[model samples]
Target: MNSYFVTATGTDIGKTFCTAGLLRANPTLSAIKPLLSGYEEEQAESSDSGQLLAAMGREATGANISAITPWRYKAPLSPDMAAAREGQSIDYAALLGFCRAELAKGPTLIEGAGGAAVPLTPTKLTVDWIADLGLPVLLVTGSYLGGISHCITTAEFLLRRHISIHAVLLNESPQAPVPEAQTQATLERYLPCRIFPVRRDAGAEDFRTLAL
Candidate 1:
């Protein structure tokens, strides 16, 4: 059962891109993002759920998206706030149950929302869910300025909680201040795990190494 919880230094840092690449590079693998924010059901094909579905060679249907992401919100905010907009909240127990059921299917990558510390609920956090699941984290980060700080900070936070990190991926942003290789080199000194570089125009072949 090769499973990993795909998390990132922060939101829009390419967690979906990296995760989708891995899934595409490895057809046998499966992925699920149980909680979603800023979701527009009508435009499912361009959404994160759609991308992941496409990567897995599946249809981006409403039922398909609903199967992977039971909780979807329209507001582009943290789960706590997004759900609040709908007069609802995260049911941690149900979320845990959904993850557990999905993980049981094997070779799954659970992608978390926002950052590792994003609040899922008032008392429950994204990291708390990762810790509870006891899965190795595949951290995704960007190569922009201050990326090193963001990556290291998140890694340390995971380390402090004794959460094992499978690998750190540096997603190269367009016109990044620093080269992604340099960021990977810098992160190697701090993160006690392998670091993979994701180019801006990289395809599935570029991620084959990490796919297996």
Candidate 2:
């Protein structure tokens, strides 16, 4: 099965939006959130992943939400810190099992929580987990000011690690300070990945226009 890991420069950069966009053309594709943090009991009732599933016109029942996301922290903090406060840790092998199970379902899109380098456990970073999954990644970067450095560093790290970066989505969030083209041009020179421009406040139809 063809699969791709969806990571971002930072949290709420539209990883779920871009992933759901892909599903518009390829309905067979399924999404997985391997280690979702900041999911309170109240938030889980209307989670980001659940919203993505809904936009894709899918019910939230089938996707790997619980098994993959073993640690759903109530506090809106980094995964590692949240798990530490709860006196628990993310089990890498169990997370891998969940990923493999999702891939077996069909073409899978695994969305990383926070950023690529987010810490899952005390020792394991999210990028290390993405490497373990062994799928090509599509990075989602918002077209906001100061995003150039974050996006380039992320892509460079992935390249240095020998991970295949399928594409980059430059998400333009609502009322965000826009980035200049020269900054994007700089990133093009340093990073080896395709960059896509996404407009702000895009609906499902607008998101579907994204080619990757």
Highest TM-score against the true fold, candidate: 1
lDDT of 2: 0.74
TM-score between candidate 2 and the true structure: 0.86
- Runs in model 2 lying further than 4 Å from the true structure: 60-70, 176-186, 203-212
Question: Candidate 1, residues 114-202: lDDT per residue as tens digits?
Answer: 99999998898999999999999999999998899999999999999999998899999878987788888889998789999999888
lDDT of each: 0.92, 0.74
In model 1, the clashing pairs are none
RMSD of 2: 2.7
Write model 2 residue lDDT over 1-212, tens digit each, in one string.
47899999889888877776776656767776766777765455367666556655766553334643445776677887877778887777888887888788778888888898988777788788888889898899876767888898898888888889987877775555645355556667877777766665555576555554
Q: Given candidate 2, what's the lDDT at residue 192?
A: 72
Q: Evaluate model 1: give its TM-score.
A: 0.98
Query: All candidates: CA RMSD in angstroms?
Result: 0.9, 2.7
Tell me the deviation in Å of residue 163 in model 1.
Answer: 0.5
Instruction: Report the C-alpha displacement of residue 9, candidate 1, in angstroms.
Output: 0.6
